[model samples]
Target: MKIDLFITCLNDALFPRTGVAMTRLLRRLGHEVRFNDAQTCCGQMHFNTGYQKEALGLIRKFVADFRDAEAVVAPSGSCVAFVRDLYPKAAEWAGDEELLREVRLIGERTWELSEFLIKVLGVEDVGASYPHRVTYHPTCHAARLLRVGDAPLRLLRNVRGLHLVELPAGDQCCGFGGTFSVKNPETSTAMLADKVHNVLSTGAEVCTAGDNSCLMHIGGGLARLQSGTGVVHLAEILASVETVNPAAVVEPARFSAEGLA
Candidate 1:
């Protein structure tokens, strides 16, 4: 199957390695992965920030970008949630029936990375190895919105030499609701502090999540507190192949986009 990679705005700018890792993992599973530089934000920020009218253009662009793909996959759960849950609303608000039809079609084909890996592809183990104690933070969209229950954990459990621990309050928000973090700094910081405390309590060396936005928020707090805990995306862990090259798994910066064609 040919898959289109929708590297969300934050991943493109702040966490390019996540996209690169996702592409590597998809190809490793014997699927052709295609990257369209034309793709941009899924209008999630605009929709969440009450800029629905302004988000219509982006929604249309997103629909147009991956319309022909057999399946559209994204590493970010929140962005995928936006397309699945809000694109139709945006089209309705614009009173564009044609756009609404396109939105429904595109949204049905979009999948969160874990959802696609476990459900669509029917594979729990991607043959990964990460020898470190780690805990997972179920991002809001992945947990509540996307309802990706146990899919990520099942994959993690299959990784060789990886010690997976349950995070306290694993379902709680990491306080990184995109604009929510910016608009309500104090509340966001307070929530983040509680999350950081829980993460530290896990005694895990690394904290992993499906979304970088949550990881960045949780990671910043961990860094400020001088904690030894590091943050990694789930895709990076799954993309690791000891035989192919251990460096790519240990250091995401070593990930090359050469195979992302």
Candidate 2:
């Protein structure tokens, strides 16, 4: 299958390696991955922050960009969730029946990385190996919105030599709800404190999630405290192959808060 890669704005700007990993992983699985240069933000932030008028423009552009794609895949579950769940509403609010039709069609073809790997490819193991004590954090959008239940865990289980530990209170939000964190700093920090405590309790060297935004928030807290734990994306973990040099593949340096920032 020819898959068009929608490198979410966040991933494109901050976590380009995650996009590289996703592209390589898909190519290794024998699928041709294409990137559309004209693609930009999915307007998730604008729509969420009462800038629906501005978001409408981006929504129209998104439909224009990916309407012809055979299939769209993005590594960030949050962005994918916005596309699949909220784009239609944005279109509806515009009262553009034509745009609504196009949005619905595009949304159906859009899939988050884990769901695409499992549901579309029907292959759990992408022959990835990451020998580390890692725990998975289910981001809010991926869990509550997309309901990508156990798909990520299924992929992690098949990874050779990876010790997948259960995260305590794993479903709780990491307190990074896009603008929500900025608008509610104290509350976000309090929630993040709870999340950090849970992640530390697992004794995992790394915390992994499908969304980089959540990872950034969690990683910032961990970094501030000098916590030995590191935050990594699911794509990076899945893209790690035992044959190649680990340093080259993982790109561990960029996973840090300062590095990602």
Clash totals for all candidate models: 0, 0
Over 18-76, each residue of candidate 2 has an lDDT whose tens digit, in order, gives: 88888779988998778877788999999999999999989889989998899999988
Mark the 10 consecutive residues where model 2 has the least summed lDDT: 252-261
The digit string of per-residue lDDT tens for model 1 on 1-261 reads 899888888888778788888988999999998888877778888887888888988998988888898999999899899898888888898999999999999888999999999999999999998888889999998888899999999999999989999999988888878888999999999999999999999999889999989988998999888887889899999998763322223332322245475
Query: Native-vs-model 1 lDDT?
Result: 0.87
Best model number under TM-score = 1
Off by over 4 Å in 2: 243-261
Ten-residue stretch with the least lDDT total in model 1: 246-255
Clashing pairs in 2: none
RMSD of 2: 4.3
